[model samples]
Target: MITMKEIARRANVSSATVSRVLNNSGYVSDDVRKRIMKIIEETGYIPSEHAKALRTKQSNVIGVILPKLSTETSSRLVNGISEELAKHGYQILLANTNLDPEKEIENLKLLKSKQVDGIILLATNRGQELVSEIQKLSIPFVATGQVIEGVPSVINNNFQAAKDITSHLIEKGHQKIAFIGVDEADWEVGHRRKEGYLAALKENQLRIVDEWIQKGIFSIESGYTSMKKILESGNERPTAVVCVTDRLAIGAMEYLGEIGLSIPNDIALTGMGASDLSKYVVPRLTTIDLLSETTGAEAAKTLLEIIKEGNTSDKKVIDYRLIIRDSI
Candidate 1:
């Protein structure tokens, strides 16, 4: 392996001069930099990141804790994070918790031990245990998808997004609207979204039936099962339904199709997350675009800023777009 010393020797420069050029830390003449770079290119010499980190006390690595790895939202967010971090010569150490809350805390401790410069958590819930664990970490931490008090986060306005979608359904003359949401333990997707749906109904002077509200996990099958129960519960049925996510809405659509119910004609449907499947599904879903990638990029930027500067609590709320489709 060709070392920086060899490159410097061949380029007729000192090792410190090569270091200054490669790290871009100190002043070096353009001619010297060009010569060193040319010698490095010719030799195909690669700098040791480990040695660089030791010298600078910066690993140039960010730790990312995700709830799940397979979801579309997660994939897009990661792509955005990767794109933004690469520009600053930073890489990510991914820790997938597979939707386990305990693993979130565990991953935080583990990543901190690995000497990551900072951490970005795609949080599932705002449990006190998780917040307490985060407070103990010395490095900068940023949360996405959920808010934690006293912690910096990049989040979507779930309440307002849900309210907008519900109000849109009402404008389409949907008086009887049903809601499909996740467990309230997840404040962003579950509690805030349901609160928005209820708020819209109350503001519009529309009646909400207890039977119309159903809870489901974040899954297609869960949505299907929830819809099935809603359909079988009572003689009174909703003219429209608002789901917390596109996956759930797709599952409900599948159930509706199985029951010979035509979308919009029989029941209008809307969902959050403008997923790829949303467009391909029959009667293409009317949904909210939470700008998952933008949020992820923003989170990466925020964490980097905190790492550069001192830690300060800040929250960034990304805007949402209501995507009107054939479903409604």
Candidate 2:
């Protein structure tokens, strides 16, 4: 029978390194990790969970709380998290909130009741109530997409990315640009994104029409309504429009079509979030790639570190890119 010690011997690493690779406790370079894993697979060696359970008292399950399961963003996040967690022999207990903030709190406690080793929240709104509930958790925890005070998180650069994309429209001679965003409850997506757009205009010394800035929920229909509002705002029509999300942008596009407005000809449009639909749309969307998968992977890795080593970074920022496509 293949033993861990023998596996270590074959892999030319200490048993502790093999243990780290199996236990997901310590850092092992990807090269060494792959080599050890390959040997384990060839030898058909399975570590005894009974011993691991006794030593660590861990359930080997991670609880993931998501705002909504149906969205492309949520799906990509889950794929990244699951891929990373699976490397360490951990499974996910998914908790879908369906975009309700209150459900986030409820799922936190529910995951705790399930005796999950750790919890990760794909946060939507960082309300005080939700933050307070998270603070009460004794187990390892991580948040993605939104930062909570003193909590470890992996988030996209909403502010800078938003500003840069807005600046792109400006560089294309779009001084009369409009913005469609969400409510301020979602601090990062709502407030930070809006602030970034506003900052870009300020830097370029441009004036914004009062009616150009509109707010809506995270929905396609809401986006349609918001864009309708922007166009009918006044005699001064914006040459371009920026929507906070791809879903919103798609909705806006539908509205533009209904009114027989040609994209980038009648009015240029931009959106954040590089969703799948963005690529295949009538006019490919010019949007920001938020690296949703990376966000999930980073949060999962951090949560594992917290659970195993009791040490982790308080915050990690994910990267994003502005994708210029046919729409803009």
Candidate 3:
């Protein structure tokens, strides 16, 4: 392993000069800086990141927390985050929470202990415990997919997206619509979406039946069960169904198929997230595109800015679009 001294000796410069050149500090002349850089590059002299952190108080590493790694949404968000962070010479230390809130809190502390420059959270919930933990952290962080008061975040207009999709269904002459949602603990996907669906129905003067609403976890099996219940319990079946996520919608579709019901002909359907599976499924699910990758990229950029320039308590809202497909 070549040391800075060796590189200095090879370049006929003092160790301090080489340090200045490597750190880009204390301004060495351009010609000398270039010579030292060339020698260091040619000799493959790698600087100690630990020493660098000790000197500059920056690890150049960012911690990322995701709800799950298997989902297409999470994967796309990670891709966006990785691309943005790499441009700044920062790497991600990933922590998977597996949809557990306690693990989310634990991972935050663990990442802080590792002295990462900052954290980016793909949050599923905004519980007080998580909010309190976030407030206590010294490092800056930005949340994606959900909003937390007093915390910077990058989020979609989930309420508007839901309302738009519901209104779209209404425009297609769907007066009797059903909803498949998740636990309200997930404010963005569950509560806000339900609120939007209700708002659209009320605005359009459509009657909402209590039996038309069903709750499911973020899973295909849960969606299937919820749909089954809705179909069995309701006296008057809904003509269309709007699901909070593509996964849920897919499950509902499977149940409909098992019952020999044709889509749009018998029942129309819509889903959110625009997951990759949405386009490939038979009839190609009509859904909302939350611009998830853009949301992740923006969250990373926001966190980096906060880490570099101090937190501005900024909140960014990304836009969404509806993808019309054969399902609806």
Top model by TM-score, which number? 3
Each prediction's total of clashing residue pairs, residues at least 3 apart in sequence or on different chains, is: 0, 0, 0
Which scores higher on TM-score, 2 or 3? 3
On lDDT, the stronger of 1 and 3 is: 1
Better of 1 and 2 by TM-score: 1
Candidate 3, 1-328: lDDT as tens digits: 8998899899899988987887778979989988998997898889999888877788999999999988888988988898999999999999999999999999999999999999999999999999999999988899998999889999999999999999999999999999999999999999999999999999999998888899999999987998899899846799999999999999999999999999978999999999989999998999999998898899888998898888556689999999999998
TM-score of each model, in listed order: 0.95, 0.85, 0.97
Clashing pairs in 3: none
* Range of the 10 consecutive residues with the lowest summed lDDT in candidate 2: 48-57
Tens digits of per-residue lDDT, candidate 2, 176-233, equal 9899999988889999999999999999999977799999999999889999999897
* Candidate order by decreasing TM-score: 3, 1, 2
Task: State which candidate, 1 or 2, has the greater lDDT.
Answer: 1
Query: Which residue pairs show backbone clashes in model 1?
Result: none
Model 1 C-alpha lDDT per residue in residues 82-187, reported as the tens digit of each score: 8999999899999999999999999999999988999999999999999999999989999998999999999999999999999999999999999999999999
Lowest-lDDT window of 10 residues in candidate 3? 307-316
